[model samples]
Target chain A: MKNIFERNVSGMTERLSRSVIGIAGCGGIGSSAAVSLVRAGVGKLIIADHDRVEPSNLNRQYFFFGDIGEKKTAALRERLLQINPDCVIEAYDKKLEREDLASIFENADILIEAFDKAESKQWLIEEWASVFPERPVISGNGLAGYGDFASLRIRKTGNIYFCGDGKSSDASGLCSARVAVVANMQANLAIELIMNKTGDVK
Target chain B: MGKITVNGHEIDWNDNMTVRNVLDRMKYSFRMLVIKVNGTIVKREDWETFPVPEGADVKVIHLMSGG
Candidate 1:
């Protein structure tokens, strides 16, 4: 009983379905990555964010105009379930503190650091690495402005991976095209990490 | 001059060289960086005092993260 979605991602669905993914933001990267993961048949997602959808966020985020003013995690969860009614999404509309991140995403096999601030990204990664030294945490970085898309890439050390240009400053402004590319790269890297860990499981 | 490897390339390392010295020497101005010295992670606040022993393997990774 494979629908177009499952039939298309035939090889990955099972392993992804057994995995629980955690994303720490629902802005451009988190929202876009969450959509891709759910569509790829990741069975559950634990997403958290303190921001609400802003009208300007439509330029890069995966939210519709009507979603403006709604909490991002909730809005994204709704959008995800609309695509796959069976997918279980736990959307937390709050700022994730150090302990909150550990308790909330305890079951997540992998995590995505999708925040927009440098300090935030660094601290989030530190907390995750401190708690789950073995689990992989994927991130998107240096994706600012447009063109030179080829410069974007995935860089890693131990279990922490970054997918982006590695030097772009956010002052250049965020654009839809480049943002989507990095967002998808984060999602793709998450899938690769998960598959590598589960390849021998099933 | 002593030596150390940073991101796989060996570089001149003076005695009592701190992480800040290595970062400044390498001109890594990127605001976000994850640095490891001899397989042990260095906290940002300790970069000034943390010592890099001679021949230590250091990884000064520049990280860029945003939406």
Candidate 2:
């Protein structure tokens, strides 16, 4: 009699156990993504973000009110443990710098770019393509404002899977539903990538 | 009139134009943003059919990278 998670993902777990998921941001999308990946049974996660929880984030972020002001990486790491104790969660509570890119991404099977800053987003994508060409990275956009959720499109770009709309919440204040919808999709994309569900040619 | 480029070509400017209109004219379907306009950062909302005065300098950069 094992947990539902363990039972449902046993096969995926064995495969994903060796898979390492790297997320660059732990705000709305990253936090929700971490939860989804844990539920999906990704073996290991490296969560990094240099921000603290704010009252404004509580509306969309999965974190509770009590967790406000806490560092996002720490909270994600702690909460992910509750969802799947066996899943290894590594938290790096700092902004991703170019120097940290190679070492941080050394073992990642898949990378999730959830950074809120546009400049950081550009750098990570550029660096990964040049330095870590083999690893797959998933990036999200356009989960902001109140638009038709149907507009969300998941596109594949080379080794990168561009999730959601590729738009910024900063441009259109993020709503709970939209954030959840996009983040969930991103998580599912990560799971599919790990499970080889997308019929990847490579 | 200043030249605004997307990908590479200069875009025509008019008061009637919006960001979406400009994007439509460019025939670009890829998600665009994390962009710069003459070295200045422009928001996505600004790309939504926002009319540009004559002679506006522009540059469009995509959000995701391959590396």
Candidate 3:
């Protein structure tokens, strides 16, 4: 019998199945990116988050009503597993520190920064760049509010790919559509990096 | 008078115009910004002190939070 992802574009299934992605911060961006990657048949994922699902998250996060109160990493892991039972997933329900990041993400081929706080995002990029200088990190910023989709763009700086408008904030509010757009952009970049056979930074 | 490029647009610059001055002059009120001068990151604390050289390229990227 053909596998669930066998029909995927030539070489995509095999390539994605061999990749391992690490996601930090299982919020709107992290959960959405996780689901997209899982659906694309990625081989493995390592996710970490200290937050719990709340009613507020339902508006934009990829969580069900039943997942309320559950730790984000646990809830997202369950959802991802339901989508792809064969995919290996490692979930951590704790905030990751700088010293612990390298070992936790040791096996990951790529890292995705899905943090919601500016300080956290800055910390992740700096630490990731210092610890895993060669690995590409996909991050999102300014994905709040609505409309002005044209401002949302993918920016590359060094080994990091930032996907978002780089401007919107909580003052303008957050919506599901805009958040998902940025999250999916990050996922798409991750997939592209994984599929690049030459392994050169694109 | 000198000129510096900000996000690709050439803007008039005055002597001793720091990153903070440019943002104020341009009326960019965003609180969260990642400012860079000539490809080097200028931390938020240094924006008031980091002076932009003539013909330098300044990129002011705003960062927002949702996820």
Candidate 4:
């Protein structure tokens, strides 16, 4: 039988199939990143979020209309499993706290900080970096508003890879296109970091 | 005049010019921002008092939403 990932000619599928990626948050960025990772053949994922799907999320978040009112982690898990039934997914439908960090991210090779709140992002980066200094963390920041897609780019600071324009305001509002662009950037960077190992890609 | 680099642009700096002053002078009104001075992150509470010395490198990163 022809494998679904046979078209992954770069040999990344094989390597990705053995890696476990962790995502914190399940909104627009988290959901989009999760879907992309699963489709890219990543074998394992650990996702945590306390949010529930709402009608407003349908504009950008990766959830169906029927998924409204469902826990984001649970809904996303269902969608991801449909993408790759063989992929191992661990979904936690609760707010992730410092106490749960170790057990939740123990096996993940990389951590994706997909939070929306500024304070949450700061705490996640600080805690995750302090706890897992060696693990690469791909984070999204300043990805609100619309247009200016060219400004969105990847920036590496220490072990954290920030993907976005680094300028948009929280009050500027958000659109689906820009959110997905940043999320996909985070996903793509995660794959590159996973494959390259050194994370020295220029 | 002494100068400091902010977000890659060199701007004139004066003695005792704090992060808050710099943001005000630069017209950066974003509420959610990460200010780094000389490679050190300045906490939100210290924005008004954290001094940006001459020749220091500063990066003001704005944090936004969408997931």
Q: Give a tens-digit lDDT track for model 3, residues A1-202.
A: 1377876778888788889999998988999999999988888999999999999999999999999999888889988988888999999888888788898988888999999887778767667766776888888988988888999999976676789987677678889999999999999999988998475322
Tens-digit lDDT track of model 1 for A1-202: 2483646555688778888999999999999999999888888999999999999899999999999999898889999998998899988889988778899999898899899988888777877877888888897878998999789888887888888998888888999889989989988988877777834432
Q: Give model 1's TM-score versus the native structure.
A: 0.91
For model 2, residues B16-62, the per-residue Cα lDDT tens digits are 66667666777767663543444344455456645555555555546
Pairs with backbone N, CA or C atoms under 3 Å apart (clashes), candidate 4: none
> How much is the lDDT of residue A55 in candidate 2?
96
List, for all models, the DockQ compared with the true complex.
Answer: 0.62, 0.09, 0.43, 0.39
Query: Across residues A130-196, which tens digit of lDDT does each residue of candidate 4 receive?
Result: 6787788888988989999899999865676789987786588888999999999999999988888
Assess every candidate by TM-score. 0.91, 0.73, 0.81, 0.80
lDDT of 2: 0.71
Predicted candidate 2 versus true structure: per-residue lDDT over A28-47, tens digit per residue: 78888889888777778888
As for TM-score, the candidate ahead, 1 or 2, is 1
Candidate order by DockQ, decreasing, is 1, 3, 4, 2
Kindly report which residue stretches of model 2 are placed more than 4 angstroms away from their true locations once superposed. A6-10, A167-169, A197-202, B1-61, B64-67
lDDT of 2 at B52: 53
The model with the greater TM-score, 2 or 4, is 4
The predicted structure with the larger TM-score, 2 or 3, is: 3
Displacement of residue A55 (Cα, Å) in model 4 is 0.8
**Residue A57 of model 1: what lDDT?**
94
Per-model lDDT? 0.85, 0.71, 0.85, 0.85
User: Model 3: number of clashes?
Assistant: 0
